[model samples]
Target: MTTPDAPRHSRPISFAIFLAIAGAVGWWAAFNLTVSKIEVLENPSVDLACDFSVLVQCGTNLTAWQGAVFGFPNPLLGMGGFVAPIAVGVGLLAGARFARWFWIAFNVGIVGAFAFVIWLISQSLYSLGTLCPWCMVVWVATIPLFWVVTTRNLVEGVLGSSLVGFGAALRSWVVPITIVSYAVVVLLAQLQLNALARL
Candidate 1:
């Protein structure tokens, strides 16, 4: 039931805060990765700060072909892409109301990022046989960012009205779902790379 007093897509302060925090964390990770990559380029002999060990380090992933999938360092993408969420969150907190089109575009971008993260996770665990700390930080932020934004859009009928109820149901389970998503990554890493023993 639509009412004048209550809009379908009301501002969510908590979601806004979440977005801000996640965006900041993601951006920080991307910045660190970019720095590491540049440092490697400047001096190949230098050991990176994030290189905790052979199995847990950023050097292997940074030098790999996967890190430059777009012919540029992947961290560049993160450095730029993460800014959008921060802006959107700050805008919402400032009482800005966005159009449905804006939300749709944002969601689409998030879906792309999510898909990319999944691919990176696969490449990291199965192919690279290593865990990059900065990359994992990006993953942690992206996972929940995707889930929360998508679910919020669904609840607000930005995706469609028909899915509102389903979105509402999912809203309460976002945290658990995020935890399970993280667990899946951990389990895969452990099974494939013996991440626990290596650490």
Candidate 2:
């Protein structure tokens, strides 16, 4: 058990920094892809399809109506959503002592972004039948970011002593169990999709 006075694990801040960097990179790549798509629309010679090979094609997923979820290039959303958190993480890493309430609010936003990423992944897998490589990067970065942020809050006693105890209990059981279960579900869903694609 961690002593009450012990410094919390530094992994959360570190992971947050790593994720922010990754997110920034992902956003940049997505933005470039979006620009490329616009160029393709302007010129017929450019094939927008992401399928450079049997396994990859941006146009296959991106040219579809779903790609413009809001009827515009979706990367703009990523650009705006990702940059602020990265800035916040960088500031925090630089020794900014954000108030507990600020951290809590940050966590809430992370949760929302995580959920949206998952939804987008599902849409790509099932509806688009192709994946944007940059989008996958965002999805991967989000998982660790969410986990680290939540774990940090728990370890740092940001949620209060009682909630910290509850979080510790949940971490020992619920967290791992939920992660494994979700992994299994995702794997099974992918297998099913692959099977259907073969048929």
CA lDDT, every prediction? Answer: 0.96, 0.67
lDDT score of residue 92 within candidate 1 = 94
Model 1 agreement with the true structure over 1-199: per-residue lDDT tens digits: 7689875766789988999999999999999999999999999878999999989999999999999999999999999999999999999998899999999999999999999999999999999999999999999999999999999999999999999999999999999999999999999999999999989
Model 2 Cα lDDT, one tens digit per residue, 1-199: 8899988644347655775686677677667667767766897467654445433456655667766778886767777777766877687676566788987887897788778777777777777666566666666656656766776678678877667876666655545754674575457446646632532
Please give each candidate's TM-score.
0.95, 0.72
TM-score of 2: 0.72
Residue 46 in candidate 2, Cα distance off native in Å: 2.1
Model 2 clash pairs are 48-59, 49-59, 50-57, 50-58, 50-59, 51-56, 51-57
Best candidate, TM-score-wise? 1
RMSD each, Å: 3.0, 5.5
